[model samples]
Target: MRPGYGHTLRYLGAARGAITRRQPIFPTCYGDALQGSPVADITADPQSGWTGVHPAILAMNCLAYDAATLGNHEFNFGLPWLTRMLSAARHPVTCANLKLTCGRFLPPYLLLDRMIRSHDGEKHPIRIGIIGLVPPQVTSWDHLHLGDRLISEDMVKASRELVPRIREEGADLIVALAHTGIDTGPAHPFMENAALQIAAVPGVDALLAGHSHQIFPDSTVPGTDGGAVDSAIGTLSGTPAVMAGFGGSHLGILDLALRRHHGHWTITGHRSEARPVTSMKTGIAAAPDAEISRALTKTHAATLRLTRRPIGHSPAPLHSYLAMVGDSAALRLVNAAQHEAMAELLRGTAHENLPILSATAPFKAGGRGGPGHYTDIPAGPLKLRHAADLYIFPNTLCGLQITGALLRDWLERAASCFNRIGPDARGVPLLNPEMPSHDFDVISGLTYRIDLSQPARHAPGGALASPGATRIRDLRHAGKPVRASDVFILATNSYRAYGGGGYPDLPDTERIHTGKTQVRDVLVRHIRSRSQVAPPAGVTWSFASQPGASAILETGPGVRRHAAELAALGATDLGGGSGGFVRLHLPFDGPLASRGNDN
Candidate 1:
């Protein structure tokens, strides 16, 4: 899928704030326009750095779509902005399945006639009837707004009603634009996705599905008869369905070959491809799409500027890379905030006397957040953007009650962030999501050892290293093994508390205490409570032993400045490699090379 001109337009909006809309907000639904710039607002480009979007959504308007459906991100900007944007769009936005009591289906489906070109250079007109539908689960994403709108009518039932009406209107073919995800394998009752359900609809001939951002190759939906199912427009059963990647990342191209016989057109051949946002001028991977960058440049610059504004002063800069190895400014800040929040929550609660400790991970650490994952908190007044940049996701705060056994399991899961070490090896991989850098568990009030020799017993199913496998052994709190039945209060985000991390026996949602506050608000409150927070006092965790050897992986062009300092401290600095990685000096004598490279 190609990004098309949308991204470029958005970039210009952000650069110049030319769009007549609100400023770009984090986790935005509207894209670069949130940051301001460009000539027009683009529905792609979430400022959080992900590359995904409903491709060429703008083209739907120019193509005079009978009725365009809504995708997941369409609601990302919240209802107000979405309503405004859709109102501004030239084409009518519609969804037969999602409607208000006033008879307006948000954007109701439209009826139209389209012109077509025959292979023989002949032009023809077709009476086509189209309707759009979306999944009901879209409510889960923006529950706040979705709460007000009526979310009833399943896609199947919706299609059954609308398709027949189109046919009655003398339209030859019934088309459905379903905003639903696809899973070809099973038909779980109570799990009626649009694709499978709509396929069974008698009146519909062709279907276009979005919200999955998936590309269908050769335009063929395999059938039980071991042959292609023919449709009025060609091979719509497998021929015409397509979804471009998200965020102006790709463009979906679908071509259909229709034949006329007995005064009716039938689809014969179908093809669909996901093309990149980059240029094909020379070849793939060579010409970076300037339009994409240009579209986002102005907005990107404005976003950076807005985020860079002074926030409340930090005595010590926060960082995630440091947290990856041991303690870091970013983790410490989170830990401090969580600790403060928990402490306040426990002030008069039943668990107040239990020597409370808060656990937090380095979520904003160096991986996807950006190259400079280090939070350089220069001293100053903090703003809303600063808080968002610091905490990112909209996850809520949740506290859980766990037994000592469960706590041990939790730490093991944290340790699992490290890779299984070869007998001759040492140190953990820098980016293990299970033991993901961000998920590195920090136990505030407990101290434990991570014995490298033992296999890591992370998660619940079974011993990840093998029965009795061990990475975390001899778990103790205050110099003694924790009692099995000893109940303790554990604080974590709502996402993990709901079994998001694959940790076992932790699916106890009843133990959860929801906070009406957002995570960023909690951090700001915690920071204000402290009046001043510092990086953790010291390293609370460390490697049991150096890898068979220790290696230094440098990062950034300015890494040399720290090289001499690290080498003098007994480490070797291996020079640079690919992925924007630089060399670091580490005294690693392991079987593996002592060099580290990172993008």
Candidate 2:
């Protein structure tokens, strides 16, 4: 969830209001109800709903018990809003691992004890120590808002210090609400993650794991150390770990079985599962939680009005074509916006004499985004929230001067997003399911073709030969090859400009310029100024030279029809074994060194 993704404050306030009014207290779930739909559209809130504190806090409040830890997406709103949200939480928000720049916990870990009813109908008091830990990546991704107020501490050291102390306080259960993810891929610290490490901590009974947004293959994951077990309810370090799915799509429930033996407690059994917010296997339905909605209605209204004000109109829905092989309506629009905005920024920079271009990866396109990733806005007014939906990241506009050689290498990285799949493929392909939304490419200002026959210069290595190569073959300028020495002024987000995605060339540029406006603002300005938007003129590509070309080649019927017309002219859909594309390389015959002054 983003900074204010939940209506947590309002939900808490409403719950408090109910308590003051002496009314029956039944919590209502906020946001969209899961009713067996594509996971992409599971939590569609155009404005006030999931964009801010509403979703995160609403979900946090729903699983009300004690303190909950913050996650990376929590900083999407920056520190001020996060602080405000944390301050407003009914229960103390604790994270011992995080230190402010002043060297102190934002909210110290709490020594909490509560009374519970045992299965035998006996009342028992249990001392439970809770500590929350958020991912430090927030400092890099959302630095604009965080400034210097927030700093993340080492998770291992934080757990190490707090464990013995909690036990000394006579606590029976040590619960770590770790926002870091677990090992979904291979089991390594970089891959397997610290959830296992946190679970292996002495005196820690259970671990509450969040952030990765995944389901455990089994209820119990063994700890690195013997005599310890990691369960969904809590980690064997002491207890199990549970993570409610993003946007309230699921409520993670961990039931722990504890038995008293010789006046001491022992965990008997435990289990955990992601209870879908809505059951879609049956049909689409509204399983709205009226109470939570009503509580947050006022706050949700203000946030929506603040963020969703219409900027312009679109003839068709501006949707994203994320992972699929075609440009999305929304992504194309953003690409056009970035292309235009970057060109303008370049014109004012020292590299104005060089050919200027802009490119952005479709971060929120396809993959886990599901079918809802498509940008299909009806012919209607456009709003800031709509723009937010188009460009989800809070990235700043940055420009770099890179030679065509480096530019090609960068494109190679973008092309690596695809993987080779065949009928006889073994197990799951090396393709990482969690390559992050922003890694997918959607280019503008330049047209190129990707050849899957070559290999990718993927991470930790430069380039190696492999049958599973993703290379740009027919990269064109006007109607010919782009010279190796061609200097291109590229406009991109600061994330890439600073080498965040391992695109080191962007940061090593000789000339770097940071723009005042954000990418989304530029897009909003572009749309409002245009007043009317149209579908892309045309974009195409091809890859039929490979072995498995025919089976892998496909596009929407609309694109296929256009391809047929293009094919009738001279372009044959080259049957490539990996995949096929309708070639759309525009002709740029302008002078190589033409400057804005000359124009």
Candidate 3:
């Protein structure tokens, strides 16, 4: 339910309108209903982060939804802010595993009473139950806002505890509004994607998965075939399930066939599939519902005004097509903005004497978002929209005190995003496809080398896979080797400081400061202070030399304009690939050399 952005909400209304025209439906959103990427942080009210409440909630109510669940992104602002947004939900927006610091407060599940007509036209009384659960990672992902103030229980554990209660309440059918992806693997504690396990929980009748942003029941999606998941018919562990594509692209539909047996309700058969609002593949679309556009016009106008506000100017083109491989001007801008603000705050503090480093990640790189997702800001005046592109999340500013030993470990975790490429290897995929681009944070104030020839020390989950493994080489600070005992004050978002994206678990005592000001606010300030900004072209890190070794790196098709930068790093363009991506043949054939200003 994107409000401030494009007509995705209108398309959502279109999907709802078309579906309901055939028959009445119990529409349920898995999560992330109130915001879209980039402009997602934009709220209806500036103080409220806008919450998308005016249109998101208003439109949800208009669509006549029975129930909706909270997504992990819902917690991005804070619990208090989220509470206010949820209060306006005309339909119940529930979350089972969420609770107040004091005790269980948010209702874990919701029940609905309705009359159902059987195939023979027999009307019977029925009670439907919905259990909502967000990813367990939210506790770590948004720990700064969730810490001590709220508690998030693991999804499967909470389901085991709450399912029986729903059954005892006389519910004939139960639907799991799981705001997590379907992972066919065996269940474990704190698993971020656990829909398959949730469906396996006894008494669970159906499941709806989200957060992965991929359509389930699509055979093209890996892990769906030859497993507990049956994508052809959209069943998980024999339970009807569907995961609608993300960003209001599709609507999931699950039809259940039920019959009365011995005075009890039983589900006999089921089918499920996702209906797309518009598809480039098939070139089909649902017409935009005019009511939603009319209802949201006022907010949309304000959004346009907000987006066009000026911030600063760019000296040259800044894009993230090359962010993952080498020096990225886009990322450098974010780090420079962060470094300046945190530096000012630390000036009068006790930890001011320590050298400062900024941790930043690439958010818009081409991955799950497809080839058009990478940031490409041409040289011109910077606006709020450009700033939003630089920093997608509405995370708060946080600073932590860390020893050099921990800093080295942090890089090891980030380095795991790449796949192991042995010496003299050629044409291997440089990145682990499962590794999200946002998790690959590169420290701005250091020079290091990533030896892809070595196995990753840390696994994608941020756990130590090999105790003695090392991928980061020649780690340095201020042109010298960093000692284990030496300390540094790190400038980062609250998400990273609290172990978001599986970086590390830092103790609360290590938190030197937690500023209420949003990181974007500081970035705006940093940009406005400068007449024109141009981040250094040099990179902070480089891949260790592997003569005769080349790897495949795909970026947005916009890479055609930056051919000169490609030559500097000894890379060649391989033209376009399916899904609008431009592939690159990055050859690590040259000798390793020093990079960036920190050196």
Error of 1 at 535 (Å): 2.5
Quote model 2's TM-score: 0.72
**On residues 525-550, what C-alpha lDDT tens digit does candidate 3 reach at each position?**
88899999868555689888787788
Model 3 residue runs over 4 Å out of place are 1-24, 36-40, 44-53, 137-140, 183-186, 224-226, 282-287, 590-599
For model 1, what is the alpha-carbon lDDT of residue 363? 56
Of 1 and 2, the candidate ahead on TM-score is 2
Model 1, runs deviating above 4 Å: 1-309, 364-383, 414-418, 425-445, 448-470, 474-480, 501-509, 529-532, 546-599
lDDT of 3 at 147: 71
Output the number of the lDDT-best candidate. 3
RMSD of each: 10.9, 9.6, 4.5
Candidates, ranked, lDDT: 3, 2, 1
Q: Tell me, by TM-score, which candidate is best.
A: 3
Query: Model 3 lDDT vs. the true structure?
Result: 0.76
Off by over 4 Å in 2: 1-65, 184-193, 217-239, 284-286, 303-308, 321-323, 371-373, 401-406, 422-432, 454-470, 476-487, 495-511, 514-516, 534-547, 550-599
Model 1 lDDT tens row, 264-368: 655544444545554535423435446555545654555565555444557654444344454455666776677667778878777776654567776544432
